[model samples]
Target: MSRLPTRTDTPPAKPDPADKRAAWADAAKGVCIILVVLWHVVVKDYLQIDWHIGVPVPGLWGALGEQFLPLRMPLFFTISGVFAANAVLRPWRVVARSRVAGFLYLYALWLLIHTAILALAPDLPTDRATSLLGLLEQLTITPSNLWYLYALALYFTIAKTVRRVPRALVLVPAAALSAVAAAGLLDTPGNRAGLYQNLVFFLAGLHLRPQIERWAATANRRRLVLTAGAYVLALAAMAVAGAQRWFGVWPLVSVVAVAFGVTAAARLGRWPALGDRLATLGRITLPIYVIHMPVLALLHRLLHAPVSGLDGVGQGLIVLGYPILLTGLVIGVSLALHRGLLAVHARWLFALPTSRRPAPRHVAAAR
Candidate 1:
C-alpha cells in the first residue's frame, strides 16, 4: 500500500512545523466548532419553545438545522481524519500516548464533570441515567456530545491495525457501514449508531489525505465553483429525500456534502484577516467544544424567554442573532476560562498530567 510522506522521511528540505499547521484546516475546524455551538444553542434555546408550549411551531431555524446536519459532524470527523493521517503512521506506543490516551482522558474527565453537574442540578432536564447501573451503562455505552472524542479514539485504533491494508479496501467497507447506519439498518443503541455513521468520513479523511492535500494546493476558481455547485445540489437532494422520509440514502448524500463543505471552508480560509481569526479559534476548539455546552445551558436557562414576546422581524432577529451572539459569548468565555485555568496551574483540566522535555533549539528558534 502506498503511503504519504511521514515525519520519518528523510527529505532534502524540512517542512516548516508552522506550515504543517495549515491555516485553512484550522479555519475549517473553527467553522465546524462554531456551527456545533450554534446548532446546540438553536435547538436548546429557540426550537425548544415548541416543546415548552406543547405545540409544533414552524420556523426557518429548525429547517436550517436539518439541512446542515449532514455537513456539521461529518466535516468535523473528516478534518480529524486529516490530522490523524500522519499520526497513524507513528509507532503504536506514540499513537497510544498522543491520540488514544489524550482523547480518552478528555472524554472520561468531561463525562464525570457533565454527569456530576446533571446529578447536582435536579431541575435541569436530563435523560441521562441516574441509577448506579444506569450510570454505568451510560459510562460504558453512551457518551453524549463527547462521542466525537470516543469515536476518534476508536478510529485511531482501527487505523493503526489496518495501516497496512490498501486504502480503498479500508474505505469501501467503512463507507458501507456509514450507509448502513444512515439507512437505519444497523439499529445500534445510542452513540454506537453515530460512531458507525461517521466512521467512513474519518477513514476517507485519513486514507485520502495525500489526494485531498494535493487538490487543495492546486484548487482553482473553476474547481471551487464546481464543488460549491455540487454541495448545493447534494443538500437539496438530501432535503427532498428527508422530507419524503427516505432514510436509506441520506448518508451517501452526506458524503458528498461533507466533501464539498470541507472544500468550500478551505477556499474561504484563504482570506487573510478572516482566516487568521478563524485559525486562532480553531487552535482553541477543544476547550471551546468542552466548555461551550455548559455556558449555553446556563444561558438558555437564564434567558430562554427573553425573546418569547417579540414578534415578526424582532422574533426572527432574536432567533437568528442570539445564537450568533451567544456563540461569540461562549467562545470568548471559554477562552478566558481556559487562560485563567492555565494561569492557576490547572492545565490538567485540558490535558493529562504529564511532563516533557523543553522544545528543541531549532524548533524554538523557528518560532
Candidate 2:
C-alpha cells in the first residue's frame, strides 16, 4: 500500500523513523478505514434490521465489534497530527498563505458541494427557510464529518505550539479528558464531538504512535496483553451498555485494543497467501473508503430478498453480512478500477495540494 502523507517527504528532509511507525501507521490507516467502511455498512444497515443474531451483538460478538467505532476517526487525525506537527514550524509565510489557507480553500469548496447536495434533496425543509445566508453561516461552522478537515487544518496551523509543549504533558490532560468522557462524567456536547473531543484522539494517536509501533514490532507479550485486556474490558462495558450508555465507551477502548489487536493479525502477513491479501486490502483503503457507501446502497437495493426484512438473528446476519460481502465487491471493484483505467486521475480523489499556492495579488496592497 502507498504510505500516508508526511512533511518529511517535502523540501528539507527531517528524519522520520519511518521504518516501523510508517508501516504500522499504514496498517492503522487500513484498520481505521475498514472501521469507517463498517460504520456506514454494518451499523447503518444493522440498525435497519428489526432482528438480531442467535443471541444478540450485545455479548461477545457485538462487544468485540463495537470497540473500533468511536476511536477510528480520531486515530486518523492522530496519524495526521504526527505529520502535521512538523509542518507549522516552517516560516510564517509558509504557514499563512500556504498550509491553513489552502486547507480553508479546500474546505470551502467541499463544504459548498456537501451542503448543496443536501439542500437539493427531496421535499426540503419547507418551514425551515433555506436561505443562502443560513447556508453560508453553516459553512463557516462545520458539517458532518467535515469537522475532521477543519480540525486538521487547525492542528497543522498550531502544530508547532503542540510540538514545543511536552507531548507527554499535553497527552496526559487529553487522556484524562478521554477518561472523563469514557466515564460519562464529562459527557457534554457528545463524546464524539466538538473541538475538545477530537483533540483527545488526535493527541493520543500522535503521542502514542511511537509506543504503538514499538509494541507492534516487539515480543508478542505486550500486544497480546493489550488486545486481551481491551477485549475483556470492552465486552464487559458493552454488557453494561445493555442497560446504560457506558457501553458506548468501550468503542474507544477498542480502538486502543485494535492498535494492539492488529499486531497479532499482522503476523498473518508472514504467510505468503494471507500476507498478500492483507497488504492488498490495506492498499486500496483510500479509494474504497471514498466510494464504499454508494456500492453498499446499491447492493442493498439489488439484494432486496425477504432475508433483508428478517428480524433478530436472521436479520442481523443478512443485514450486516450483506454489506461485508458487498464491501469485498467494492474493494475488488476499486482495485480493478484503479488498474483497469481510472489510474490516470486517481490522484484527484485523494487530493491535497503539496506546495503552497501564491497569495492572490492583493490590489489593495499594490495600491
| Model 2 lDDT tens row, 1-367 | 1123222122222223334444445545666666666655455443344454665543333444565555566556655555454455577776655556655554555555445444433222111115777555545543333455566556555554566688778876765665555555653431134444566656655566566556566726565676667666666666666622452363366455555544654444344454444444554554454344444544444444455456665665454356566556756665565444344643433445566576668954786
Q: Which residue pairs of candidate 2 clash?
A: 51-311, 51-312, 52-312, 52-313, 53-313
The parts of candidate 1 lying over 4 Å away from their true place are 1-21, 50-58, 119-127, 243-248, 305-317, 355-367
Q: After superposition, how far is residue 349 of candidate 2 from its true place, in Å?
A: 4.2
Q: lDDT (0-100) at residue 312 of candidate 2?
A: 63
Q: Model 2 compared with the native: what TM-score?
A: 0.66
lDDT of 1 at 210: 85
> Lowest lDDT 10-mer window, candidate 2?
1-10
Candidate 2 ranges with C-alpha deviation above 4 Å: 1-18, 49-64, 82-138, 176-195, 219-222, 241-262, 265-272, 275-284, 294-320, 332-349, 353-367
> Could you tell me which 10 consecutive residues in candidate 1 have the lowest summed lDDT?
1-10
Clash pairs, candidate 1, are none
